[model samples]
Target: MAPLESVRQELSQQFPCRKDQIQVLSTLFEASFPSPPTTVVHGLEATGKSVVVRAVLQALDVPHAIIDSKECITTRQLLEQAVAATRNSVHQALGTGLLHGNQIKCETVNALENHLEKNIKDVPKFVLVFDGVDRQKEAPMTLLPGLARLGTIIPNLSIVFIITVPNPRLLHLPGTPHIQFPTYSKEDMITILSLDPQDIFLERVDEERYDYGEEEASEDKAWLWPRYCAVVWDSIGKGAARDLRTFTLICYNLWRPFVQPIVDGTHGTRDFSKLLVSRRSIFQGDEALTGKIISAKPSAEDQNNRSKPTFLELPYYAKFLLCAGYLASYNPPRQDKIYFMKSTERKRRRRGGNAGGRASKHRKIPRHLLNPSPFSLDRMLAILQSILIHPVAQTGQISAQIATLTSLRLLLRTGAGTADLLDPATRFRVNCSWEYVSSLGRSVGIELRDYLAT
Candidate 1:
């Protein structure tokens, strides 16, 4: 048997902040034989519940079969597969595969019990783990309680159920021990994430060391990474990041960009507040914080190059909404009919005859150069309908898309103290830069210059 301390240490290394759970599991499985009929490791998703249990069982060289009940929804299929898996797991550990017995078919709870009683009861020791047992096509009313009491019938067998929900009453196993894994706290998250601090820059270019390890990187490791995680938690993880898996993915996508400015000497290593201000766009908007990372792996050359993020793809109607919002915000309301309205009237051009007036003395600032002016939703929609080739979609659907844009911070809602969402007076302004909207127009094959009034 592996030393208890070594096994505990191994588990601690694999899963940090799980010392109590590890201690309990080690004590439960490490003994020669066990008591309780069932052990449940339950918690919210991605809290290291299943992984931690699997690690501890492996550390002690325990023979166990972990069946994901989620894969086979049917009760009969689940029962048969569980039997087959249990047999394979036990025989492989016992080196009795050469003398394999006839396969037993178990479709119902009664038959499953009979098979386990006659065949599996004679085994020295065994464990069966069911992950996500609540996900069954057939309601698992009797099967759960049946397995929960299976240990009394077969002393050699121990059963474990790994679940994501916190409803222990559903099991109805009174004496069973429930090991719960709660969602990680921010401090715990920072500690866990900082365990493996990734290097920002890999290559040594032009004599100035770009290491996050020796001098600057040590600070980056100890100081920068934690603050960055705290910022991420504040922006998105507080609500959207339900699990560590998704939270980790978001961090990975933003980490490279967050550190690029520092690597370029645009900001100092100690200017954390400034760094956050500069990189606000990357995390401040719902679009960046909730968006998925591109799946394509960066090439070696591309990875070496300091590449900035490109434009993320938007929905088709969303493109039109953005373009229309830009036009409505920047162009004067007086010129709306001239550019947007369909007409055949030609007007005479203005002659530069040196007219003497205060207007001529003062050069008027271009509308595009000034801050965006708020426009009514109806006017923006009218502009959108005129430009779009396809018929304007349902009003509710369009409204929902506009709300999505607002949440993304692409468009700012200028209305306040208003309860009616569809009020004619509700106004919004484009929150994007001129160059950005120009690029968006190009992508959609629309020349924005033709529609401009300035």
Candidate 2:
């Protein structure tokens, strides 16, 4: 059998929904068997790029080295890690005690090449997979090409770079041959998730907790498991990411609630199905509270009574900052506010040579419809002090509170750079809801409605 055929068969069984990517990778693997070239595999997160490559190499029985770029910050660190992985692979393959002695440092690129040549003498052809290549903060431009050129310098060395960036130009490697792994669709995700045969829906009852007439309830649970899974997928599973690992985890947690009812023999499959179709409250709470549970959709009364812990948790001054920002965004300044005016100055010319320019009407934006506007630090502080019931004494403490708010992302900086907050160029904009603003005002014993235009 050809090498590519062998790899294709292994890939089809191990990794599904990746037929095209497997074909591309098998060809690359076949090409690298005789002599290797630098290959870059790029894709989005959770697309299974690393998994496919690892499966292919293992199936082909090719000795490979692995390096995580997050750990390798500098050129020297990259060289050291590469040399270490190479040594470990050699030790495992030949059953040699080559790694037992004192560590010999390989800090430079030349030293790395010499070390590779020495260790890989027995095993001539192998691959080096560098995961997270974009994570290298320094020397990526220099390090990538250098690693690629190692294939040419060494007789049978191939280098593969795994990156999350889809665009090649961002990494400054326009000439590198690349293969992309696309994100999976919802149907594809469902097909992949079904491959797992674990009895996730089976409910095992504890003998000590409660004793019933029946010893086990597998028949009842077996019937309802499929329906419960269908309801869960329709509700939130369709919107989730396409990663198989995450999808399987969600499936397990979603099935946990259905387990107890089946085990205790309190509810059967038919009852559960009716509740799911009528109320659709599976996502709201656990299975025990299915009947007693209210709809996940909130009513007007619920919205009014909703306790915003995030709003209530803020410092006193931060609430004032939010109130000030709301006022600044919705209300126009006096110089900017224009109305009908009678002046004694010279008449301005119109296009038809009229006596005065036509009056342009200024429109005021609705208070509720307004967005949070950027306010200077001094302006925000002034408003804060005026609205605050008790006066704040220290200037340093006020500055500290502003820093705290900025760190918590309640007060976002609106300027171009991270300049000092007190800098005249620096500004801030509050990012919160109108409901939250009013609630904060009420907690401070002030009615924010009075601040808005009628």
Candidate 3:
């Protein structure tokens, strides 16, 4: 299959869209004929931006090229490539007679204008499909002016730019009108997964069954159905559903031989630890194991306290999550607390009190110590440390960082452990402190802050 066809097939299987959107884009392509005007489609990653562009091209039966802006090392390089490719393709289709003695000059905006002028004088219409437009670090701001100029200079030449980006804030570019692709809903995700090639799904199902004994498999189809559904739901919720490639990877990992054997024998509890380890490896690789050891190792204070440290080498991502306070105890005994923290003072007091005195006096109630709630400075520091130490190549680490940052700002206002932390005045002060600290220091920027805070 052609590259675009394969991409189209993948998109058709994974993305949720109304038939009308596909029809409209298809119709637009069918009607298109080497036009100079451009339409821009922009959205978050895995939201089907490139797929829509490819679908249109396929429907129109036109040969087009797709380029990723992010992969370009510099703006000038990207512009040079885009201009050269566009000029070469157009010039080839419509010979020198249409050139009218005009040489194509490669000044960013001027080149685009010159191309558009030549196209109008020459070919009926032409399309240039630019994918990953927003990914160019500087092109959006620098090259957009020339692109906008095309609207007035060469109305006949059509351009379709498709951008898949993580930040919606980037859409504020001048003269670029874009259609945003929203994140898929749970129902939409389910529907898309159901439509996935049966063979693919069955492969996952078969892999999941490898550890099951024949007798056990015969008795519990009902239980297995929910397990499959849960896996699908979790996979989608975690952002794997957006891209078929990633989703397939998730399925392969979830039902891999190593995990299935454990799942088949036990009621999923044994699998939890393995799942955590696997997820860490998937997200962090060797770095995660290193982070786990670092986190599990006894802290300096733990050594002085002479208590068995509760810290165990957690998965690096889990440690990151815990540090960011994303993985808080569900319905903790104290609403203000995040994780359970052992109190050295209480332990000391209990040891001293137990030495003598009335039974009641010696038997003082142990005070429970819980980690301060999410958004505490301690948690933020822990998360930041994990990110700094862990390898940066992990998928979803950046998103996880951002989510943690958002959670931190909210938590700071609530105070780490103080009951008075709920006061509006205290919360406001905490927010201001976060803003001030983040603005003044690179270590506390929004991205880092979010990772730590969460």
User: Which candidate comes out best when scored by TM-score?
Assistant: 1
Cα TM-score per model: 0.60, 0.55, 0.43
- The worst-scoring run of ten residues by lDDT in candidate 2 lies at 335-344
Clashing pairs in 1: 212-217
Report the alpha-carbon TM-score of model 2 versus the true structure: 0.55
Clashes of each: 1, 0, 21
Residue-wise C-alpha lDDT for candidate 1, range 1-454, written one tens digit per residue: 7799988987887788888899889888885646356888888877888788888888878888788887886888788777888777767787777335676677787787776666565466677888888776785678777777777677788889887774657667677788888888878787889888777666643444443346656655577888888899898878878777777777777888898897888997779999999998888655545335642445787776747446757887888889999999998898887788756655523332355633555566666789999998889998998677766665787878888888899988785826665566788889988778888888888878778765
Off by over 4 Å in 3: 1-20, 32-36, 63-65, 91-105, 119-122, 140-142, 164-177, 196-229, 232-248, 257-454
Residue clash pairs of candidate 2: none
Better of 1 and 3 by lDDT: 1
Instruction: Return the TM-score for candidate 3, rounded to 2 decimals.
Output: 0.43
The better candidate by TM-score, 1 or 2, is 1
Tell me model 3's lDDT, rounded to 2 decimals. 0.47
lDDT (tens digit, per residue) of candidate 3 on 1-454: 3444454455455445634355445545554333335566766666666776676565555534455677767766665556656556666655542233344345466765665465446545556666776556755464654554565556455567676543444433355445567655555544555553222122233436466444444344333433443454563425434554455445444444334444454435234545544443344322212333465457798787876423233334433433343323211234222222333322211122334664544443312122433344343443344435543553466445434444555334454544543222332112223333333333322242322312
The global C-alpha lDDT for each of the candidates, from Candidate 1 onward, is 0.78, 0.67, 0.47
**What TM value does model 1 have?**
0.60
Deviation in Å, model 3, residue 314 alpha carbon: 32
